[model samples]
Target: MSLELRSVNYPRRISLMRNNKSRLSGFTLWEVLVVLFLMGVLLTSFTPYYGSASKHVRLQMNRANIQRIEGAAQLYKIDVGTYPHSVTDLVYSQKGMSDWQGPYLNEIPSNPFNSEQSYQLDSSGRVNNSSAN
Candidate 1:
């Protein structure tokens, strides 16, 4: 039978070609390397002075705070006739408040450098002369 037989396979190839899809997402190696280099440059610019300036600021601030505490204590002594035995005595009346002019300074001074220890006080409630170092 020499009847017309148009190729059936030809139509299936066209359908398969229509179904294919290609899409791309995510950073290439070059893009990731560029981002890392930019971060490194920024970090290097600020790193040199970052540490010293922070320390200087802390030390100066602590010195000023200690000075303020010293002044408050002087005022307390003038009114009470003697410094309290320790810093705690200022907060709670240990000896007597007959002449106590405080609650001097709301509470007590705190260490600016390490909050683990408060600004040191001597046996008496005065600032410890050696605490800063």
Candidate 2:
């Protein structure tokens, strides 16, 4: 008998075609590469701003440390009647000041910008310092 297989095969073939089209509907390789390049460009533009912000934060920390050291020195002077000859003297006993109450700071802090460089105090107890980096 002559059977009409055309109708049955046509519907299956159409469905298969539709599925293939749907699978291919997403982004192509060129489109994905373009998106990645744009993102790189956007991030690079903000790099300078991030660099300057970090430097500013380091400088602020150094200034705050100097202020703290100066305050502790002033307190030591008030109690003992003169500024200590060095920063360590603030945290340790000198010779014979029975009234000395100190260890003013738990420990000396190094410069934030340069760990190898310690803060300097002038006759006036100001911080003038250098950085290794």
**What TM-score number comes out for model 2?**
0.74
lDDT of 2 by residue, 1-133 (tens): 1346887788999999999999899998999999999999999999999999999998888877888788988888778877767677767887888767897777887787878787666666555554312
Instruction: Supply the global lDDT for candidate 1.
Output: 0.71
Window of ten residues with lowest summed lDDT in model 2: 124-133
- Candidate 2: RMSD to truth: 3.6
Residue 79 lDDT (model 2): 86
Task: Return model 1's CA RMSD, one decimal.
Answer: 5.9
Tell me how far the alpha carbon of residue 132 in candidate 2 is from the true structure, in angstroms, after superposition: 12
Candidate 1 lDDT by residue in tens digits, 19-57: 653214567798999999999999999887998899888
